[model samples]
Each structure stands twice: as structure tokens, then as C-alpha cells.
Target: MTSLTLTRGATDTRTARATGRRTAWVPTLVLILGALYCLVPIAWVVIAATKSRSELFSTFTFAPGSGLLDNLHDLSTYRDGIYWQWMANSAFYAGLGALLSATVSAAGGYALGRFAFRGREFVFKLMLAGVLVPGIVLAVPQYLLMSELDLADSYWSMLLPSILSPYGVYLMRVYASAAVPAELLEAARMDGAGEFRIFTRIAVPMMMPGLITVFLFQFVGIWNNFLLPYVMLADDTKFPLTLGLYTLLAQGASQPALYTLVIMGCLLAVLPLIGLFLVIQRFWSLDLLSGSIKS
Candidate 1:
């Protein structure tokens, strides 16, 4: 038996991709269903925020009601609009802490990626080990240290400790190793650029995509975190949205009026991250995020 076939690069590529897609449908559907499951709560919160307290429980659960403005007004007037204060506090801590953590991670990761120094492996391994230690363990000691320095129950206490992220460091290390070529660093050195200059001019730009991811990761982690801020902060005025919401929910256990407010607050808390992602997407280099960890 004999077979005759004709193929071209463009046609072969198209056919091969088509065949692959035919095999990928099951996994793709599963992923889409998982995404929908995750997004359903978010949808419910949005719809719930639009409803009045009575509508929230009485009306069809997902039906939109006419209470959006009233909810907003109540939230705005609640405790003299302390909810907005909590929101601003979260933004400050997450934004500033993420920026600093990204910078620190970029510096530390770039150095380890491009250069070998005494005890480099030991230090990197120790840092990787730190990532295994849960945030809970650090919360108590970090609180105690902040108290020792008279920084406890303060914004600085939250902002300062949040800036050191082991995961951000690891992400940057992976990103820098893959995205940055050692040749470029050597070329920059050959061009008489100082280490700092090479880093600022060359390495930073190349690693920006990874850095933005690191920043966003850290920002979201800090934004969602409850325990550390809960332990460190005492003043309602200094509380981030997450901690503030926890307090609000705790109060709601005794006073049911706060239930509506908590739902609306949850709706409001999600907007900043969504808005940030949209804004940062245009500037972020996502190509750097694709790579592997060494064994």
C-alpha cells in the first residue's frame, strides 16, 4: 500500500492546531466552568448590593433592586464614612508596600540571577524556606517587634512589615533568571555603566513585567490579609478594608443591620483591584511571567 500527501507550513500549522483544539475541549470546558463557579459569588455580591435589606432576603436572590443609591448613602454615612477611610488605608498600604517589595525583590533577585557570591545558594535556600513558614507565625513576632519599637497599632506597623514578601522575591528570581540575559549585563558593564546604572537602565525594564505581577500579587495578598493587620492595628481609623470588614461582620453578628452594610462593603472592596488591573495591564510585560523553577 502507498499513501500520497501534500502539506504546506501554513496549512500544516493550522491543521495541527485544529487537531489540538479538538482534543482540548474537555479541559477547556472544565476551566470555563471553574471560572464561572468562582465568579458567581462576585456576581451575587454585585446584585445583592443593588437590593435593599428587605429585597436582599425577600426578592429573588439574584434580582437587581432599587436600593443601590440608598446603600451607597448609608455606607457613606456609616460612622461618618469610616468605610472610605478603611478603603484609603488599604490602598496606601497595598500600593506602597507592593512598590517597595517589588523594588527590593527586583534588586535581590537580579543580583542572585546574574551573579554568584559567597553563600548565595545558602541565602537563597533560606529565603525559599521562609516562604514555607506561614504568615501566622510571623504575625505574633512582627507584632511584638512593632510593639517594642512603639510602632504597634499604627499604619507604619502594617506598611513596614508588609514590604518584605518571600513570594515576591521568589517570583522575581524566577522572572529575572529567565527574562534577563546575562549577555546584556556584561554588555552594559562593557559600556562603562555602573552596576546600579545597568540595573536601573537595562535589567529593570526587562524585568518590569515580572515586577508588576509581583507587585499585584503582594498588593492583593496585603489587601486580603486579615490576621497580621488584625493583630497589629487597634484603631478603627487605621484599619484596612479587610480588617475593617471583619470588624463590621463581627458587629453584624449582634446587630443585623450591619449585614446589608457588610455586603455593600464587600462589593466596594473589590473595585479597587479590578480598576488597578485594568490600568496596570497596559503597562505590564506579561511575557516575563512565563517560565520554570530549577530543581
Candidate 2:
């Protein structure tokens, strides 16, 4: 009877082990499927961009074609290189807007995180509410406001709305609260440092990671923004990549050959974002490492 009991316990242990191993695989399989789901479309765009207009529909979906150079040459030369103009516009909007947003966010967040004052909670809560309100909901109101100021259909219209990011402020606030020590600020004050000096010299470095996060988020948001620019700008000369590509797509509906250009444009559009991530990721890593060491 004791032998029988021991044998049953061993069998249960083996069963549990097998079940755990199978359970572990479930999450792994799910992750793999999720990755493929996201990656397959990107892969399709890359492959399709290589095909010429004829091969775009005639060739196999995943097959590589030999027209990548031709597509690029055509896209570049199309309508006096307007594609590059769109690229430049997008870069300017995203770059300058993100920089300004990050600066404002850092200042607002540092103040909210470090200071004790009247209505501080109220202000932070208001900003949090702003974060919850979708940008789409505010687009029309923003357009009306810009129009009242007579700034519609200009670069200012594209940029002015992007310079303030409630989400970026919220993120920086949380990060500053945790990352910037009150004791350090006290020490700086004791050493006769001005508030501005303390912020620029001391607090900024400590909050670098959060700032970078905010910058990247704001940059991507402005880069991919469509509705705000669509509502504001009528000129193709000032349109960012999103609206510019959209115009190409609209034209493509009538002229089927433009579809190839659209595909090629999409592939090129993805390159800047990829390069930005790769470049910023290095700084992000270094900041994290420095932070860990400082801690």
C-alpha cells in the first residue's frame, strides 16, 4: 500500500511538470503570433515597394521584384521632387515641435513634481484630464481658434498645436517625482544656486530619460499627424508626409500607376522613423546606464 501511494505521488508530480511546460509555451506562442501579425504587413510593404507597377499585381505577394531603383527614381522625379519636400516638411514639424514640447513638459513637470503650492493638485488634475481628451475631439476647435488668429494654411498652424503635449507633461511629472530627489534640490539651494540654474544643470540631466521619452512620443505624433494639418493647410507645398501620402493615395484611385508610387512612398516614409528609433535608442540606453550607476 505504501509503494502504491508513492507511485501515485510520483505520477502526479510528472503530470504537473508536463502541464507547466505546456502552459509556458502558450505565452511564447501568443507572442510569436502577435509579432508576426504586426511584422507581416511591414514585410509586404517592403516587398511590394520593390515591384514595378505591372508586377505589383501580377507577381506573387511576397516575391521580390527588380524595380526598386526605378520606383525610387520615379518617386523622386515625380512632379519636381515633391516627395522630398513632404519629407522635409515632416522633419521640420516633428523636430521643432518635439523640442519645444519637451522643454515645456520638463518645466511643467518639474514644477508640479517638486513644488508645494496652492492649486498645484488642481492644475495637475486638469492636465491629466487634458491627457484623457482625445486630440481628434479638439481638432475642430483648434482649427477654429487658429482661423480666428488668421494663421490657417500656414506652417504655424501645423506646429502651434503640437508644441503642447499633456501626456508628455504627465509622463515627465511622474518621472520627476520619482527620479529627482527633494534632498538634492535643497542642497542646491543651500549652495546659492538659482532655480533656473538648478533646473538646467541638475534636474535636467536626472530627468533625461523621461525627456527623451516625451520628445520621441511628441515627434512621432507630429510626424504622423493628419487631421490637424488637413483641417489647417490647403497647400500641398506645406503638407507633411501623412497628408502628402494621402494626396498621392487619392490621386492613385484615378490613376492606377500612382499606386506603385504610393507603395514606394510608404516604404520610404518608414525609414526616418526607423532611423530615429535606432539613433535615440542609443542615447536612451546610455541615459539608463548612467542613471543606474548614479543610483
Candidate 3:
């Protein structure tokens, strides 16, 4: 009787294992299909950029064309190499805006997380409301405000607005609350350390992973932002990559030659973001992403 019972249990376990493998294939297949759907467009753009003007319309969409160098040369020479200028502008705005935004977020979030003050929650909630507000709704008013300040059509107009990200603050707030220990702060306080020193020496390092995540997000937002910069800056020289590519596309409607340049410009534009992610991926811990880190 014991031998028979053991045999039946082993058979059941093997059957369950087989069933689990069969059931898992469906979700795996679905995920693969979703991934392809997203990546196909990017693949098309990369292939499309290689084609010359004549070949762009003439060749098969996926077929690689021979004018990669030629297209790059045309893009570089277009309007005295203005494309490079736009790339630089994007880097400046995203880099500086993200840095300042991250700093402000860290401070605000740390304060909200560590301190018990009057209306602290209210202040944090009010700032968080900014995240729910769409950028489009704020753009016109922001433009008007900047215009009134005589800062419209300038770099400051774009840079200043991007430096206060509510989401960044929220992320830092949550992260600081969890990642930083009250005991550590108390110890520092007992040792006669200033608030700023405690934050810089202890909080910042412990919160580095979260802060890097916030910085990457803010940087991407500022980099890809089009409508804000469009409404603010009138000069092409001040235009970021998004606006620059947009203007190029508008021109391409009349002059199809510019389409190749637009495609090439897009391919070039993504490289910086990819590089940024590769550099910062190490700092953004997988454990944090998995929701294992809690406040």
C-alpha cells in the first residue's frame, strides 16, 4: 500500500510539472508578440534612414539602402550644421534641468519624509497635483507667464520650467522614507551634524539609486519635450532635438529630400538616451524596481 501511494504521488507531480510548462507558453508568446510590435517601428526607422531620397520611396521599406553617409553629410551641412546645435541644446536642457530637478526633489522629498511639520503633507500633496496636470494645459499659461517676465523665446524659458518635476519629488519622497533610517538621522543629530550635512553625507548616498532613477526620468522628459519648447523659443538655434526634427519634418512635406535628414536625425537622437541608460542602469537597483524596497 505504501509503495503504491508513492508511485501515484510521483506521477501526479510529474503531470503537474508538464501542465505548468504548457500553460506558461501562452503568456511567453504574448509577451514576444508585444515586444516585436514595439520594436518593429524602431527597426523600420533604422532601415529607412539608410536610404537615399530616390531610394526611400523606390526601395522596399525594410531593405537597407546605400546612402547612409550621404544622408548624414546632407544633415550635417543643412543650415550650417544646425542639427548638431539642436543636439547640444537638448543635452544642455535635459542634463542641467534633470540635475537641478533631482537636487530640488531630493531636498523636498527628504524634508517631507524625515520631518514632522505643519502642513507638510498638504505641501507635498499640492506639489504632487502638478503631476496629474497635463503639460498641454499648463503650456499656454506658462508661456504667458514667461512672456510677462520678458523671458520668452529664451533658453531660460525652457530650462526653468523643467527644473521642478513633481514626479521626481514624489519618487524621492517615497524612496527617502523607506531607504533612510530615522535612527541614522538621530545619531547624526546627536553628533552635532547640521541638517544639510546629514542629508549630504548620509541620505544622499543611501538614496543614490532612487535619485538616479528620478534624474533619468526627468532627463528623458526634458529631452523629449516638444510643445513647451515650441511655445517658448522662437529661434531655431534654441530648439532642442524634438523641435528641430519637427521643423525638419514640416519642411520635408514640401521638399521630400528633408525626410531622409529627419529619419537620420531621429536615429542619431536616440543614441544619447541609450548611452545614458547604459551608464545609469547600474545605479538603479533591480531590487528597487521589484518593489522589494519599501518605506
Query: Compared to the true structure, candidate 2 yields what TM-score?
Result: 0.94
Backbone clashes, candidate 2:
0
Every model: Cα RMSD to truth: 4.6, 2.8, 2.7
lDDT of all the models against the reference? 0.87, 0.94, 0.92
Q: What's the best-to-worst order under lDDT?
A: 2, 3, 1
lDDT tens digits by residue: candidate 2, 26-87:
89999999999999999999999999989997867787999999999999999999999999
Tens-digit per-residue lDDT, 124-237, candidate 3: 999889889999999999999999999999989998998888888898999999889999899999999999999999999888888888899999999999999989999999
**Model 1 lowest lDDT segment of ten:** 286-295
Candidate 2's displacement at residue 31, Å, is 0.9
lDDT of 2 at 94: 98
Where is model 2 more than 4 Å wrong at Cα?
1-19
TM-score of each: 0.89, 0.94, 0.94
- The numbered model that scores best in lDDT is 2
- Candidate 2: give the clashing pairs: none
Q: How good is model 1 by TM-score?
A: 0.89
